[model samples]
Target: MNNTDHTTATVEPAIRLESVTKQYVGAETVTALADVDLPVYGGEFLAIVGPSGSGKSTMLNLLGLLDGPTEGVVRLGGRDVTDLSETELTDARREYIGFVFQDFHLLPTLTAVENVTLPTAFTDGQYADRAVDLLGRVGLGDRLDHTPDELSGGQKQRVAIARALINRPEILLADEPTGNLDRETGVTILEEVRRICERGVAVVAVTHDELVTEYADRTVRLVDGRLGEGDDGFAT
Candidate 1:
């Protein structure tokens, strides 16, 4: 092949949405997303920003495989998963995706180390050592014995982040992850997330905070269920 052809060879995206749409069929039909096309590449951070009810949550669900599209396809590693059985989807989700929510979601009764190792319950307990390492990586080594109620907001969020990493997923989907924290605390949380992206995991965060745009490799705006232009070139 010529040099130009070699250089231009396309790499499959970690996750992709093709002409996707999501709608609710309650009393009256409501469209949450419409014809959304997006690509999340490994080792990059993509931010989804929008006003309230603009479908940011819907988009996150689709990306995380928690929900299927009403139309079009959702692909993981370039393979269409829009028609997978529930059991297959569950397996794929456990193997390929991790999620961090706005609420720390740590069990108030469990110690930080226990919360981080919870995912291992689904498989063998061999991930115990890795859980400890991840907690240290998130700056929670000294607070492993503390429960959610005992830790500060930033620390709790850090624990949540460490918990998300236990499965060693290829994609991390964060929904308003910094929403509950103060600006300074949120910045720290975002820093930890940036480190995760640096480790070659595809990170997609849905947020209303414009500050997150600064940390993203690309930012795409959502408006009334439609995707707007995306800004690129912020990668370190």
Candidate 2:
């Protein structure tokens, strides 16, 4: 390879896996991800799609740092996550990762603004204030004081998204973020996701919904713990 090729190869992937394999042992052993190699760049919207038990959610969880692989290396921005201690992994998650989920997991007791600001408690000065600003930016300024029950489903989702963005992470990992919403509401949430990607946050969402791919910059299909054929696509 030429020097340019070497340089390109050295460039960091925002999220990456090399020969990654995941397995669970119960009464029997099951492989959830097998010899997977994937890369996500710094500013892309990538969707992971597949049927049930196809490893889509497992991939998301691993990328989100919610779980570690049984074998192989996982890297974030060139850092080797697999080699990190538990405390280091926890700190890395706080500093570099954001997560959004389908169920709109907002605390019913807290207001929207509080929900967004909650994570900031573990962070430093001005964190709470920044969370409030994020909520406002997500168009929740008027609903800041509303609890989950006081808001519409979509509004609650908006709050959940704002909460995810509170730390301004480099990558946003969303697991079936629209699964609980109606079609229109789902689109609205996805549009917000697209907006986040526009701002240069890499977004990876796991979903079974084909309509969601329309918003993604790239689509990857997983099947039986492997990357399926012809699963790669660029924006048309």
Candidate 3:
């Protein structure tokens, strides 16, 4: 390898919110998030914690590209994607990001491997072997043929974790990832997620569950639409 290769390459955040804000202009104006600047790097696990109605969901939506910021920009791999069209945004989402929802939204009719490959539906490739491998990564190799109802809550979540990794996303957005499970199961799931982070995927999780902080490399909190790094917006 050329020595210049290491010297010339630049590292950028996997996804970031640069001076972002979101407001709901209804009968009343509601500022969901205000001027927040956050950068999540690969191989890092970041936990965003706050009470309900404190803009956690709003942040997740922005990070996941499900919605855009009313101000500032959302950047992916250092590229500004703040103003992408719906089609472009959809493609961006599919190519760059993965999500783990608390509900484990697996299709009841699909087996674990089938559900793991769902995100690749519009692509022209089949990923059966990769899906099987991801299931094995999450300790669900034996459950590949099981449907959502056939698996326990934790097993379903393990499947969800595997599904999120199938696309090899640079960033993984987990919304309340452990909210639906008991303590022991939740710990197992968190371990799987941390392992994913260690493999160089950026993991951003929004949660009210304090247990997430134990696995996170860093923690931040949102309060009244503002972001900070302390107990309630000071630590960042």
Better of 1 and 2 by TM-score: 1
Clashes of each: 0, 0, 5
lDDT of 1: 0.88
Model 2 over residues 116-149: C-alpha lDDT tens digits? Answer: 8776776676866776788888788888888999
Query: What would the TM-scores of all predictions be?
Result: 0.93, 0.91, 0.93
- Candidate 1 regions with alpha-carbon error over 4 angstroms: 1-8, 231-236
Q: Pick the candidate with the highest lDDT.
A: 3
Please give the distance, in angstroms, between residue 231's alpha carbon in candidate 1 and its true position after superposition.
5.1
Cα distance off (Å), candidate 1, residue 24: 0.5
For model 3, residues 47-95, the per-residue Cα lDDT tens digits are 9987788899999999999999989999988889999999999989888
How well is each residue in 57-129 modelled by candidate 1, as lDDT tens digits? 9999999999999999999988899999999998899888989999878898999989998877767777777
- Quote model 2's TM-score: 0.91
Superposed by TM-score, candidate 3 places the C-alpha of residue 217 at a distance from the truth, in angstroms, of 0.3
Q: By lDDT, is 2 or 3 better?
A: 3
